[model samples]
Target: MGTVLLAAGVLLWSAAHLFKRLQPAKRAELGDTGRLYATVAIFASILLMVLGYRWADPVWLWPRAGWMIHLNNLLVFVAFYMFAVSGLKTSLARRIRHPQLTGFKAWAVAHLLVAGSVQGVILFGGLLAWAVVSVIVINRANRDWTRPPEAAIWREGVALVAAVFLMLVVGIIHGWVGPWPFGGGA
Candidate 1:
């Protein structure tokens, strides 16, 4: 049952993002409703995935080998860098509105290196697929890649703060937070 829910959540989450590129005029007319539905689907899917994982039985296959863990850390570091630069006003984000999504994919892929389970695969795999597809869609839809230089010191500052916060969270989760539904100490 838990596995089923996790898979369902991933499917729903992917579907919402996949359809986000449908007719611009229609999407505009749908307005907040469309946004709301997308938000709801994303949130609900995530919630369901979490709950399913919490309730599911674990079946770990690969041990968190030293190299895998190191890779995870490396990818996470890159994720933070991508996330930070994407929000900077240095004409970086103009090329990508989905740095956050890229970060998510990195995070998921990194985790998969250490975690091997049906639930883990579904959650991370779904998110990874969504990130890739969304990025492609956005890249295709974008017309003007050029823009005047814009700088927001505050935005950069906030991104730094967020990066620090996320680093701390990762440390806690990976080092202190128990493996819980998984095993072998998180």
Candidate 2:
């Protein structure tokens, strides 16, 4: 049942994201309303996915390695930094048009490395594929890219600080709810 829900949630989320790219004319016709509906579906699907993943029985494919956890932690930190910089008016943002998607890719990959269960593979692998496809679709859609205005270097510093703070908060929550990120005893 949980696997079914997980698959359904992944499909819903992927479909919602791809709808605009697949049917641009239809998406434009709906305008703001379409975006709102898509947003809601994405959030709802995410909720369902999380719940399904938690409830599903674990079927580990391989032994958990300590090094994998360390690597995942590092990649997650980088992902958070990319996410933080994506919204900020920084030079990095101007250079990386899809920092958010890149961050999502990193996040999904990081989790995938550590989680060997069927649910983990479905959830993280689905998201990674989505991010990859999204980047490709977006790049093809926007042929002419206009670079953003230059931002102060200090803005990047601020983004980095914020990223660190976000990482701390998320790590704390992860430790509380699931695995201890630091390889400590669960």
| Best candidate, TM-score | 2
Instruction: Give the alpha-carbon lDDT of every model.
Output: 0.73, 0.89
lDDT of 1 by residue, 1-186 (tens): 888888888888887777668467776788999899889998998888777777778777666666776787778766876688676643456555667787888988987887777677877877788788877887788854665367665776667677777776767775553442223344
Model 2: worst 10 consecutive residues (lDDT sum): 177-186
lDDT of 2 at 10: 91
The count of residue-pair clashes in candidate 2 stands at 0
Each candidate structure's TM-score, on Cα atoms with residue i matched to residue i, is 0.77, 0.93
Query: Once superposed on the true structure, which residue ranges of model 2 sit more than 4 Å away at CA?
Result: none
Name the regions of candidate 1 deviating beyond 4 angstroms: 90-98, 147-162, 173-186
